[model samples]
Target: MTAITRLTVLIPEVEPAHWWQCARQNRSGAVIDRALRRHTDAVVRRLRMRS
Candidate 1:
């Protein structure tokens, strides 16, 4: 069996355009940074497990 972790970001109150603009401008925002870190960590963990 395989286990998968899914992370979802919800910003229902924010306008789509504005949210996208902010994300584009601040790629290193806390939320974005955390998500990226989690994703990278998952990939690295998988690779290590395979070796």
Candidate 2:
């Protein structure tokens, strides 16, 4: 089981449109969490390629 931490994110005034679309549809935490994980994974991959 994965442990969870409480986060306080201060998003910019103009947030990503898809994020709001998901929120409005009540997709909630799960979708956002996966999106973050995917983004993080991409960053990691880029860094690994450069090293």
Candidate 3:
């Protein structure tokens, strides 16, 4: 006698129009990412003495 195993996978149906749009859709923690980006940009601007 032998045993059989089965596997299943799920996929999304919607299609993205752009590469960046697709990447963002699959990402989490957008608020944190935006905050960190803003902080880094502010620091860079300050160091560069930009208004």
Candidate 4:
């Protein structure tokens, strides 16, 4: 089971492991096109698994 580690009322795409995490973390359907580095992808995937 993915334990809710983050305390933010935020969704699953905000405040990523870096600056280009995603711009839509605040809004629901913003779709921030900032391309995250490859390393960022790994982190986000790990986080997703935990969430």
Task: State every prediction's TM-score relative to the real structure.
Answer: 0.24, 0.27, 0.30, 0.18
- Candidate 4 local Cα displacement, residue 14, angstroms: 5.5
Off by over 4 Å in 2: 1-25, 41-51
lDDT tens readout by residue for model 2, 1-51: 999665443312222455445344333444555576666542211111110
Ordered by lDDT, highest first, the candidates read: 1, 3, 2, 4
For each candidate, what is the lDDT? 0.40, 0.39, 0.40, 0.34
Considering every candidate listed, which one attains the maximal TM-score?
A: 3
Quote the positional error of residue 18 for candidate 1 in Å: 24
Q: What are the per-residue Cα lDDT tens digits for candidate 1 across 1-51?
A: 999886544322232354445554432334654565677643221111110
lDDT of 4 at 21: 46
**What is the Å distance of residue 12 in model 1 from its true position?**
24
Clashes of each: 0, 0, 0, 0
Off-target runs (Cα >4 Å) in candidate 4 are 1-14, 27-51
**Clash pairs for candidate 1:** none
Candidate 1 residue spans exceeding 4 A from truth = 1-28, 41-51
> Poorest 10 consecutive residues of model 1 by lDDT?
42-51
Tens digits of per-residue lDDT, candidate 3, 1-51, equal 899554322222344566566664543334445565666543211111111
Better of 1 and 2 by TM-score: 2
